[model samples]
Target: MLISRFELSVARRQLLHNRGQTLLTLGVVATSVTLIVFLATLIGGLQRRIIGDTTSMIPHVVVSAPERLPLAPWELPSATAPAAPLFVGRVVKLEQRLRKIEDWPAVVARLRELMPGGVAARVAVAEGQGVVSRESNRKPVTLVGAVPAEFTRVVDLQSNLAAGRYLGLNGGEAVIGYKLAADLNLRLGDRVRVLSSEAVSADFLVAGIVDTGIAVIDRSSLFLNLKDAQSLLNLGSAVTRIGLRLDDVFDASRQRERLEQYLPYEINDWMRDNQRVLSGIRAQNDSSRMIIVFTVLASGLAVASIMVMSVTRKIQEIGILKAIGAKSRQILVIFALQGLAVCAAGAALGCAVGWVLCDALGRIEVVVSATGRTAQLFPVANEPFYYGLAAGLAVVSGVLASLYPAWSASRVDPIHVIRGQ
Candidate 1:
């Protein structure tokens, strides 16, 4: 039997009789919902950031032949570049034919010939850490020496410029990231000294300031001309790493397999280079999802508790209905309706509040890392989905939680209450 309007009214009155408990329950539900949404949103942003570079910025294939000799860990000309083991360029001496080269300007050449469109810009690399001085204070930065136009094709250097312009190959010019410039108190045309282990006396003019938005890059990256880099590092034409950019970033594994025919060098995608960091991000994402489930479960418990309290307070009303010949099922229907009302209302409120908060948090800044390099949150940022999922989970939980309590209310022992037993 369905609960009647009169019974529903009685139940509603009973629920409102204690304003404090109702408010307390609502507060608990809302808080749990919010926490679940916030954590999911944060993890979602991290996933988007890590995948964006690979999916959008990187290419499908990369080719590089290994050198015949052993590769050692390379130290930047300064100390700014990430510390990493050097590759053995021994395979670099091989001139094997590519059995099934798909793209012309065969990717094999990218590692061996050092020709145009090769894996890396054909030039010298002077890597090292340096401190850009600003009057009295200094900021640590990564310094790279490479040609602008060619280097940009592999990695867009010009796009990072925030003030003035990027440097040309003429030499005697430098580009500093915005954060580094801020630390160094440098402006366009300002002369800045660059010191590296390769050389004791080296300096260049600040032609531009770059803003990577990535805290690490903005504060620690400096671009120098390839000629200047080669001269400073004394590499002549030796390059430490061949950064291969493919036409399709997702197909890197296939490309790596194919490139092996011509180039003996090992080819690793960006993800491979930064597996530890990416793994950490994945673990965090899993943890966030688990937390959401527990949070929703907690909210469900609140719904149950509220219903229990509502049922307990309505014994007198139950007694009156029973005396009037109403069956226990009918009496239970009224309380169940009341429980449904609270659960549904709470779910809707929680969803709305969670969505808004997650979207707003997305506006917060995030830092992401990849390939021994770190980049700040860029254009591909998206984190709202996480919050939405959390809210959906909450709604489902609310409904499920209400069911058991509603059933319990419907099974009340009306005879005892009416007889005052």
Candidate 2:
């Protein structure tokens, strides 16, 4: 029901009469909302930064040759099972082999056609395990070979370069991770010998040092020109896999599914490969939401308790109103209006304070790594949606908290209160 001017006047008078208590309750509600807004923004921005850092050095999706599986004699149509006279024995496992995608250039072209605007970059990579040595120091590393320009589009290697320059289009030039360079005591222009698993060896000048923040990549990875890697790995004209970067990283899984339907090769997405990281992010979000919920509930309970006390203290006024021509519904509306005013004021104050705090914190930067990589410690997200959400929660909490107390005030007995009972 709509509140009349008389009910609004009564509500205003009651709150003014107990100005201290009203102000205290408003402060509590405001503080709760402020906490909610700050936490939500901080957590959201943190999750974004973490996901960006993790996905920056990796391909969103990878397309490769399907895995090779060994078949038993009975499982293969060409092999006839021996007559059951001999003792049963398990089939010997086949030697592990590096599978290469056949006709990968055409496959890459097909991927681009299928994805259209979705595909940002598609680069074929020749990868293999090898050992790199500078003088006496030797370290085992994963050798990756691709066109520098194309590979950088897939994985942002150029932006993460710590020293020197990225791979040139010429042979005998290599880019090594900063950790690997450190381990081997190597520097730019230092000639290092790399021996592939196939025993093919080559000497390359350390052209670049990249610090990707990912331990695995930074510790033991090497990059070379596509032809050089192919020669070292003995892959001839074939590549180990094709990596695709999407316009939106989160679309990797959906695109992977679509690609699987269109192509016969094995397709994998970052989401599938990084299940643990995604789980951690999900947990962080859930925890932040729970914290906000509890904060709002606590504020609601505080409002409810204060309203209940107000109802107790105003029994005589309620009885007098009931004794006169005032309706029980008017008494209820007056009390509810008091709650709405307090919550509305508090929510507005809270939103203002929260925004200021977030803005101040966002300006402060912190060094996140030894390589001079810096980031905002708070990274407060200033989205209006979060502010609206916090205010909405507070207002709803206030309305619900006022309900029972308003009903109790409306039920005060005129005769009993008149007798001072």
Candidate 1 C-alpha lDDT tens digits along 319-397: 6666777776666666656555555555556657766765565555454422123344322223456545655676667
Candidate 1 off by > 4 Å: 1-22, 43-62, 68-159, 166-206, 211-265, 315-341, 351-383
Residue-level lDDT for 294 in candidate 1: 81
Instruction: Supply every candidate's count of residue pairs whose N, Cα or C atoms clash at under 3 angstroms.
Output: 31, 0
lDDT per residue for candidate 2 within 1-421, as digits (tens), equals 4877899889998898899989998998899889988998898788887888878888999999988765554665645656554443665545766789869889988987898897889899999999999888899999999999999999999988888887464699999988888899888989999999989999999999888888889899999999999999999999999999998888999999999999999999999998898999999989998999899899999999999998999999999999997888998999899999999999999999999999999999998666676779787887898899999999999889988899899988899899999
List pairs with backbone clashes in candidate 2: none
Best candidate, lDDT-wise? 2
* Cα lDDT for residue 394, candidate 1: 63
Would you estimate the TM-scores of all the predictions? 0.55, 0.79
**In candidate 2, what residue range of length 10 has the lowest lDDT sum?**
85-94
lDDT of predicted model 1:
0.60
lDDT for 34 (candidate 1): 68
Error (Å) of candidate 1 at residue 294 is 3.5
Task: Return the top candidate by TM-score.
Answer: 2
